[model samples]
Target: MTTTAGSRLRALLADGELITAPGVFDGLSAALVARTGFKAGYLTGAGVAVAGYGLPDIGLLTQTEMTERARVVVEALGDVPLIADADTGYGAPMNVVRTLRAYEKAGVAAIQLEDQAFPKKCGHLPDKELISADEFTVKLTAALDARTDPDLLVIARTDARAPLGIDEAIDRANHYAEVGADVIFVEAPENLDEIERIARSVQAPLLINMVQGGLTPDTAPDKLAALGYRIAIHPGALLAPYVLHGLDALGRLGGTMPDVTAGPQGLFELVGLREWSAVGERYRDNTKDGA
Candidate 1:
């Protein structure tokens, strides 16, 4: 049997090199990330809310919406492992069981659950509310127990830095790790000092969120690796540029069409037109032969 993406991610994590995952909201982004030879892709909640649904990342997406999108993105990603965001596990601790199964069934290699209250805002955003650490621990435990595959990572994220303090966020991160979370994420640490402190303080493999124009500084990959960080997810790297360029393209559409280089064929090629055409040809001959 082929090694599952979860198994692959476990191996990658064991290798001790920093795993960098670019955020992918849709199949196109997932395919592009895979094509670019990334180790993994993050199904970013923010990206999905903004790019997929034209909504903000204020916890508006449903479990079904995220899972349905995960299935498409996982298929498009092929062998690449996907680390998906399951905001608050979609509800209470018991709700996490169904959410965990749904995401696992969708073939994501990892599921990230945060400690924010229902209707959670983006980590970088202010006015975020968090459930008690003990409450989140129960949710994390539920997800961990509900996981069918041991290799499927359960990442625990704490959005307490902005609301509580860096010390509280670090404490929550360690507590989650102790409660069977495979990875620990301390979200939106504002400075290099907090970033270093998180790496030093957390007792498990650490994951950091690297958001441009957000609270965290853009730490270099080498520096992060040096700091003993395991995973770095840049959630808006693609979506930000895509949105900006899309706006520019929309503005240009009212005038003469800009010089078109990659027309339909080239764009289709990026999405495996040739491979699909070959499959069509093979089936067409069988259909014509009535076999």
Candidate 2:
């Protein structure tokens, strides 16, 4: 029997291996990560906001928009499991029910829901507020109940470290896991000690987000695995590099770069031109003589 993508991810986590997922914004970035042999990929909301809408991660993306982005990345990734960041489930508890179904339909293996209130900000941001634990539990329960496939992992994240402190954040994470969160994410631990505390305290499978230039330290993946994190997602791995080098590339360019500047076929192949061309050739030369 063939194992499904979600099953693959669940098995990877179960086997005691630390799964590292690179954050990808679109189909091309997804394809790149898939080609590079990463076990999983993350569809990050922050990446989607800046890449798709040129905005900040300030609760601006809609549910439909994020689903569409995940759909495309899922197609690009084929059998690779994608852990999608479904920010705050798009609204209240009822909205979380629908949001879960939509993302499942989009073929994501894991869905992450945070405890931040509506109009959520990025996890690394300061002055962040969180909804009451009871309120978040309702949404988390809704997500757990809404999934038809049991293989789909529902990750519950708490952004209360800066606001409520690490101990409270870990408490919330434990409560979320007790309430049906498949994995626990305590976002933005300030130091190594705090990071270690979250790892040692949380009983369930844990996820660590390594945001470039964010609150978390540049702890190595092996270190994180040793610290008891089962899954590590670098959500801005591509976005941060892109912004930094993109500025330099733009400055160096005397004029607007042409379509075919970098690669042999330019940006066309980046969009799968060769594969698409083969598909087009099949139709264009379907003649009697196989022209």
Candidate 3:
């Protein structure tokens, strides 16, 4: 049997090297990331909300909306695994079951669930409230139970760092790990000390969220690996650059545009138009021969 993307991701995590999954919000962004030879890609919720709907990440994107986006990105990313963010499992325990089934069917390799209540703000954002450890545990348990594929990672995220404390966040991380979470994410650590502490305290493989200009201090991937984090996701790393360059190009439209000489073909080729064209010709030829 062919190894699934989830199994491949699990095996990669088991081996050495910290998985650096750059965030992608759409199919083309995912294609770009995949083309660069990234082992994994993350479907960032905040990126999806902002880029797709022109909204913020205040739980505004619905479960169906995010799942549909994941499906598209997954299709674009053939063999590459997509670690998706399932915000608060889209609701309570029962809701989490459906959420898990939906995302799994969408071909995501993993689904990250946070402890924040509905209308949850970005983890880097302040004043984020969290459901109790017990309440969050129920959701994590539901997530683990809901996955038919055992290799599908169920990541439990705690947004308690700023609201409660690092101690409370670490405690929740351990609690979620104890409840059978495949990975534990202590969101938005204040500094490197807090990051090291969470990595040391949590029993599960740690996932560090490296949001640019967010609460957590940026640490090198090797340093994070030394601290024992298995995965680091830079959710806004690409979006930030993409938006900045777009604005720069738009501002200079009256003048010479950046990369304008590359032309439309270069843009289409970025998403594999030539490869798709070959596939179309082959299909037509085969159909004609059969007819």
Candidate 4:
């Protein structure tokens, strides 16, 4: 049988230097990322909540919504692997099982589940709490069991660094690895020292989130590879640009604004406004022949 996208991701985990994936928020973003020749892409919770629902990443998006988005992103990328964020597994152990199966059917390469308490907020946000480590282990095991294909990478993320401490986060990561997580993500590590500690501690491949202006500084991919990190997802890198562009466009559209001229006569020109007309023109001959 041909290897599925999930299996391919698992194989990539075992290979060389850290896999660098840019965060993709929509179909257009995913397509653009694939065109950039990156090996993988990440579906960030913050990006999804903000772009899909125009809401904060405060447990507002449902499982169906996220899974549907994953399906769309997977289709858009074609063969490019996708690592999706499944926040707190959307509920309990059973919920984790369902979430896993849904993403699997959607053809996601990997799915990351965090150990945050229910109604979780963004990792960089405050007032975070964690479930009992043992309970989370059960959920991780359930996620592992639910996967029909071993190639489906199950990434366990710990949000305990800020609330519990670095030691606790490392401990939790180790425990999750024991429970069969393919990769360990110690989210929001405070500094280089902590990142080094995580790189040394976790037995499974380590995945790090590098968000600009967030808890972790933006480190170069080569440096992360030198520290033994396996994969690094810059979930907010592309998003920051989109946010800034939108803000600037809104500002320009306000009072005393200068008109911005359109640039280039390529894909943007045709797809921006003339997409339907272009499609009609392409099929116009067929329709005329039928008539």
TM-score of each: 0.86, 0.86, 0.86, 0.86
Over the full model, what C-alpha lDDT does candidate 3 score relative to the true structure? Answer: 0.85
Identify the superior model by lDDT, candidate 1 or candidate 4.
1
Identify the candidate with maximal lDDT.
1
Give me the displacement of residue 57 in model 4, in angstroms. Answer: 0.6
Query: Residues 51-152, candidate 1, lDDT per residue (tens digit)?
Result: 787666767789999999999999999999999999999998789999999999999999999999987777876678899999998899999999888889
Tens digits of per-residue lDDT for model 2, 1-64: 9866678889889889789999999988999999999999999998888777766676778999
lDDT of 4 at 269: 26
lDDT of each: 0.87, 0.85, 0.85, 0.84
Which runs of model 4 end up more than 4 angstroms from their true locations? Answer: 255-291
Clashing pairs in 2: none
Residues 77-99 of candidate 3: C-alpha lDDT, one tens digit per residue: 88999999998988889999999
Clashes of each: 0, 0, 0, 0
Which 10 successive residues of model 4 have the least lDDT summed?
264-273
RMSD list, candidates in order:
13.8, 13.8, 13.9, 13.5
Candidate 1: regions farther than 4 A off? 254-291
Which pairs of residues collide in model 3?
none
